[model samples]
Target: MRGKSSIEVSAKLKHSFLFPDEYLDWANETENNFYVESPLIYEVAFYNGIKALKPWETIEYIPVVLTEWKKVKLEIESKFEKRDAKGATLPMRVGIGLFLELLFWTNGQPVELNPIIPLESLKIKPVNITERFAFILARPNLFHSYKQLAELMVEMEKLYVKSIIVRK
Candidate 1:
């Protein structure tokens, strides 16, 4: 019964887009349940600036390294390149969001930005908060053209590369 209930809850979460806070709350309630993996939701919360109530001390925390950054950059670049080659007109919002999500996972202190900034933007400017941390400033737009999104990704890559260099 417990396994079934947990599966249902997990399915619901996977199917619907919930705010980070909602996922955090669900994870907190089910953290002790072996059938439910709370750490995954905790990751989503952490990426969105909500610290988990109970840190996963037992779990190995793999901080993003230079190799990981390179992997992510190459993957994203390949995706966009393929899309461009196919002449697809798909919106780049999702790709941009993925970039930001990955950026937040980097080792650093969380930097707060104005709440007014739209989560998805054509141009996301990274403001270096510390030697290894940044807060993104997003210019509001309904959608991003391929060229604009590619440029933004390049800029973000430069910032991450600089931070990685400082960390080394």
Candidate 2:
């Protein structure tokens, strides 16, 4: 209960080495001090970088395909009710947050979809690519300390900067 928490003090010390001088100046000038100063920047950036690796970037559009689970469950309830009344073992076709993590921030702009695309016209297929998914929320990981987090920030800051600078 003094000036700064251990994590905060550690981050301030680490940022000097992690962020480039030019980026620091740019961050200062742009009124986005939190970008450079936040202790959680590394975890935030690492997660965002993970999101930036979507396979659909070449298509120049990312789709937020959502399946409402309860609705799906109800729709399919009759078929499975006799066999499995609980519906405890519902498969991926049922809505779960796993599919959401499969989505990433694509470089391509989000396409404004036409309201009239027939359901049959769309291809219904599983994602073919195999990739690691981090299902956890943004919180302190037991393995990565503030120092390790800062190191990750050093690696990802350039990408983060490039992405935000255009918006600025």
Candidate 3:
């Protein structure tokens, strides 16, 4: 029964157009591709994450007001744990990676506000699927087909770029 369900999902995925044909072709080419399951569950998970962001309409930034650094860090960590529990896929890890980058990136930038200023905040921008795949490509050793994936993402980006809006 489990095998039947897996097969059914695979059939549906091939026709779903959730990802570009080039990407689907590359992912399906190898049986032992790193973290690239035949059913492409991880890719689907990543797509689902991006869809949650409503990218077709607008790319939303998660606004977080700063009170104390530690408190914000803890809250983010808790959210990460919850997301991980659902499925610790590439997208989830990319989110945590972006968070870490934000921490470091913000530290060097100068702020003109007074030290006691209230509600000073930072926005966490959403990374599109192509960007997320590029992030994964940075660690090429993890996936043998990383270069192909990167190329495919570029194509996918070109096709869908017009529909995506960057919200101010």
Best by lDDT: 1
What TM-score, over all chains together, does every model reach? 0.36, 0.18, 0.19
Residue by residue across 1-168, what tens digits does model 2's lDDT show?
Answer: 222211121222222222223121122222222221222232223322322222223322112222232343343344344544334223212222212221222222211112321223323212221111111112222122222322332322343345446656
Model 3 CA deviation exceeding 4 Å by range:
1-144, 164-168
The TM-score ranking, best first, is: 1, 3, 2
Residue 159, candidate 3: alpha-carbon lDDT: 32
Of 1 and 2, the candidate ahead on TM-score is 1
Model 2: lDDT of residue 9: 18
Clashing residue pairs in candidate 2 (N, C-alpha, C atoms within 3 angstroms)? none
Indicate the worst ten consecutive residues by lDDT in candidate 2: 129-138
Report the backbone clash tally of model 1: 0
Per residue, candidate 1 scores C-alpha lDDT tens digits across 56-147 of: 33212223222343454455456556655332321233343334433443323221223422223322245432211211113212223334
Pairs clashing within candidate 3: none
Cα lDDT of model 3 by residue, 35-115, tens digit: 311223333323423211111121221122112223433443454456443332333333322332222223222111122
RMSD from true fold, candidate 2? 19.9
Residue 113 local lDDT, model 3: 15
